[model samples]
Target: MTYIDQLGASAKQSAKVIATLSTATKNKILVAVAEELLKSEEEILTANAKDLELACSKGKKPAYVDRLALTSERIIAMAEGVREIATASDPIGIIDTGWLHPKGMEIIQKRVPLGVIGMIFESRPNVTIDAAALAIKAGNAIILRGGSDAIYSNTMLKNIFVRAGIAAGMPPASVQLVEQTERAHVRELISLNNYIDVIIPRGGKGLKSFIIEHATVPVIETGAGNCHLYVEKSADLEKAYAIILNAKTQRPATCNTIETLLLDYELLVAFLPIIAQKLADAGVVLAVDLTCMEILNKHKIIAEHATSADYKTEYQALKITIVAVGGVEDAINHINTYGSGHSEAILTEKMAASDLFAQEVDASSVYINASTRFTDGAEFGFGGEIGISTQKLHARGPMGLRALTTYKYIIRGNGQIR
Candidate 1:
């Protein structure tokens, strides 16, 4: 058999064990994986150093390097993420409902793992451990395919996590990272629908698109966070300042960071002077629309008229597009047209306005007087996440253990056949 075939067969076998594992046993295994990540931090860092060196040699962008690098603190967080999952309630066998049929059959639908999940991610080594730990907790086997840029780090993490899970009595093949990093590997991996129940890609638009377009197996489209934050005419200015600043600058490199700011025309003058200075001080480039340019006409803030394309782009940097909307309803229409459906927020204190925004925004998560950053799985108390999903089918928002499983119907019949 070919290499992927062997791995697929092993994962398929391991899925049987994963599906039947007791919650307590699964928790112990997940905890063990966390401990292993902590114990192997030094080794993981050593492996990561190799990747960083290569990335630097290739002159990768600062943001790219930041995502690829690992620190002692980051490692602890990765391990803690696993422990958090261990603490969550097991979702397996929770009956959706039970019904009796006219033909004397009783049927119940219950949660179960989605068999084998194939994760194709970019250069975030931490995902290596996070994905595996979550798979164990959710009772699903995982096949990992990380980018070539993070080969060393992913390889090291996969080894540590899988070894720990195996030692804790989990199936040996429960977590498998692709041994090769060639582009061809991903092409092969995503085509294996018979073995891979789902293909989840976690990265930029390019990576997410590649998998969604090419994968023969089921694919989950994750967050591309062209997220927006709107300031209604009646918004609390102080609250808007805090929420907008946090959402845009707290971590601009993250998928949840706000990329566009929709302002009510009535609030434009009042918000421009303050929000402009804050964003400029934070080194953010304001890609303004015509109305905003006129509003900030004399404010010597770092500003430029926003290009039409800026509204649709996911600027993974300290930059934002500012556009003026006629009102709250117009704001909703603008967002629904341009938003990526990842996360959106409104910094309004008006209960009516907040209700309108929350109800009308077409996003995975909508917020009132809050930052879009809370769209994260960990922030939502899901321990960690496979990724923030943007699609409607299956799951949306931050995907935790519960999102990793599908349901099965168990029917008990008394010799009845139609």
Candidate 2:
């Protein structure tokens, strides 16, 4: 058999063994893996250094490098995240609902593993542990295909997991990483319909699009964040400023960061200048529509003219698009048109406006009087997420242990027939 075919068969076989493991066994394995990760910090850093050196040699952008690089603190946090997952309640084998049938039968729905998961993500080495820990907790085996830029880090982390997990009595091949970094491997991995139950792709539009077009197996779509932050006319200026600053500048490379700023026309003249200066102070470049540009010009603030494409872009950098809208309705319309359906937030004091925005915005996560950055799995108390799903089919929002599970029907009958 070919390389990917062998990986697929191994994962498929491992899934059955993992699915039968008790919750305590899974938790024990996860905790062991976490401890091993902490103990192997130096080795992990050495591997990450190699990847970083290659990324730097290729002249990768700072944001890209930041995502690929790993520090001691980050490794600590990664370990802690795994421990948290161990602490989370296991979802497997829990009865969701039950009913007695009129025909003398008992029907019950129980949560079960999705069998095997195929993860295709970008250059974030921490995801290696998060995905494996979550999949094991949810009683599923996983096959990981991380980006080429993070191959060294990913391989090292996966090796640690496999070693620790097996030592802790977990089944072999419970977590497997694709060593091949070639583009064709992605297609082959996703196309393993008989082996992989579901494919989760976490990356840019290009990667997601390729999987959607090529994969024969099921997929859960994680989206790009062309997220927006709208300031209603009745918003508290200080609160709005703080929320926007945190959402845009705190970690602009994240998928949940705001890419667009929408201002109520009535509040535009008053609030725009303050936020513009604050973002500028943080080295954020602004691309503004005509109305916003005119106001910024009066205040001697410089900005680039925003193109139609700018509104639809996920900057993933220290840049934002600014626009003036008539009111909540107009803001919602613009967001629905340009937003990526990931995360959207509104800073407003009026309960009515907040309610309207929360109810009307088409996104996986909507926030009021808060930063969009809080749309994280850990922040939502899921330990760590496999991905933040934007599609509405199987899962949505920050996918935790439960999101990785599906349900099966169990029926009991005492010789009762139709």
What's the true lDDT of residue 328 in model 1? 86
Please provide TM-scores, in order, for all candidate models, with all chains considered together: 0.97, 0.99
Q: Which stretches of candidate 1 lie above 4 Å from their native place?
A: none
lDDT of 2 by residue, 192-271 (tens): 98799999999889999999999999999995889999999988898888899999999999999999999999987788
* Highest-lDDT candidate: 2
Scored against the true structure, residue 136 in model 1 reaches a CA lDDT of 82
lDDT of each: 0.89, 0.94
**Model 1 over residues 71-146: C-alpha lDDT tens digits?**
9999999988888999988888899899999998999999999999999889889998888888888889999988
The total number of steric clashes, by the backbone 3 Å criterion, in model 2 comes to 0
